[model samples]
Target: MKKPLLMIVGAIAVLAAAAFLYPNAPSGNAAPPGKDAKHGEKGHDEGHGAEGVVEMTDAKVAAAGIEIVTAAPATLHDSIILNGILQPNQEALVQVTPRFPGVVREIKKRIGDSVEKGELLAKIESNQSLSVYEMRAPFSGTVIDRQISLGEYASEQKPAFVVADISTVWVDLSVYRRDLPRVRLGDAILIDVGDGGDPIKAELSYVSPVGSADTQSALVRAVVANDGMRLRTGLFVSARLILSAKQVPVAVKGSALQTVENRNVVFVRSGEKFEARDVEIGSRDSENIEIVFGVMDGDKYAARNSFVVKAELGKGEASHDH
Candidate 1:
């Protein structure tokens, strides 16, 4: 009887120690973290973690003309800029050559002289025909180069003069391999003729599949009308390759975007507070930029006067620096 009583006392002591170490949980449940203290609400939970949030008074927002726009689906236009040089039209540039081995007996046109179609250019004494015949201009153009002199012997293989029609020209552009996927025939391109004038409009006529041996770039050719002879051969020019419009799910006005701390950000309105939210950007045009990620639809963001948010953020940084 004494041994059984000692064993029961030891069991009671162990139970008392276990209950002291691990107590039972409370009967009622606890509320989750970050919930509203009064009503346990979640309406203000979204976008709470964004940093650089600036709160403005109603008067200040109105005085600054801060307009808020909602992010929505829109169309985006993309473009690529290119560089090129103007060249003489290859189809119109021709070498005036003799049909037979001959000696030039008479010459009419000189370098820089203009000639009309079927106009007499020179007279040659043909060696094969044993007779003198007249050589006339093949087309109405200017004599750009001259190799034959008066009474000079010329052969069928040698050209006497080079003629070219300068009213039209070709713009040969360099399309890199990275840009080749977007470039196509029939695409419209604007050529900056570099004369303090408006850009010339032209259609992309050709693209060589093979890359150039010297530049390792594919050649894109466009034909441009050279009225008043403004576009000359060998003149360097810039090209803007216009792309088609594409609709996207999210886009914003370019005026709303600002760079903050090395990150592209847009100020989103949460109640009276404007939070600068980091964003990822995609294709863009002059007016609108496509947002690839960050910020959701129906989220109001500062459009015009977004610089005011940037200024406020700057003030906060300045204060922290002090």
Candidate 2:
């Protein structure tokens, strides 16, 4: 009887100790020993919850009328950019010089003065070949340069007045030798005057046969009409040369194209994910650009604001590494 009683008392003490140490312990979700209680399973559950919150915020922004465009097949016109200088047409520039040596009796027109054809520019008293010589304007235009004043000596070798017709001006543009084969006479061109206005239209009048030895560039001359006398000679202008007329596939905006690793690329939307794809580019217009390859027609692409997508992709990659 004494042994039985001792065994019962020891059993009761062990049970009481266990209950004090592990009060409120989980029954079915007990963790194994020597293992982390919160590992992949716990992390995945929290990560998915955070992702759900971010998705909801993004959906709200899209519903606010923010414009988004997808890639589509469209026509694009090709163009080439070239540096140009404005100059007076040969037929419009006139130099006033005396036939013989003489003393200038009077100077009529000053610089920046407008004159007409056959208008008198100055009067000179002949000293070498004749007497009382009168200098007249060669054409109707503005006096761009006047080097002689009253009582100044004039000669046949020196110009007294330089006049220019601003109705039509010539723009000398430089084109790369590699592109010279595509450029030809009579091609339409556009000149940006840099005056915050509409560009002037012109046509290619001449193409140089030889390229510059140093720059390896060929000279191309275009004639632009200055109907309103808005364009002035000696003003720096930018020229755009039309290269081809064939219609090729292009994007709606040029900003859609991005440069990656020294190559052109664009982000393509592939079923809730964006993939960066290298592309072959050909031509570009004022607003759109031609896409050569690495994309298919009707493919969904980030037309504008693609930097956001890139940032998200980078974050995901970083998280995976961490």
lDDT scores of the candidates, listed in order: 0.85, 0.74
Model 1 CA deviation exceeding 4 Å by range? 1-77, 127-131, 246-283, 286-322
Winner by lDDT? 1
C-alpha RMSD between model 1 and the true structure: 11.5
Residue-level lDDT tens digits of model 2 in 148-233? 87887787898988898877888999998888888989998878899998878888989988889999899999877887788888
Candidate 1 structure quality by residue, lDDT tens digits, 1-322:
9999999999999988977886763334655554455547545434233348888876788899987899998877677888999888989988989988789999999988889999999989999887998888899998878899998899878889888898889899998888898898999887888889998889999999799778768999998888998987877999888878788889988999999879999998888888888999987887788898887878889999999989987876665444
Best by TM-score: 2
Q: Note the clash tally of each candidate.
A: 0, 1
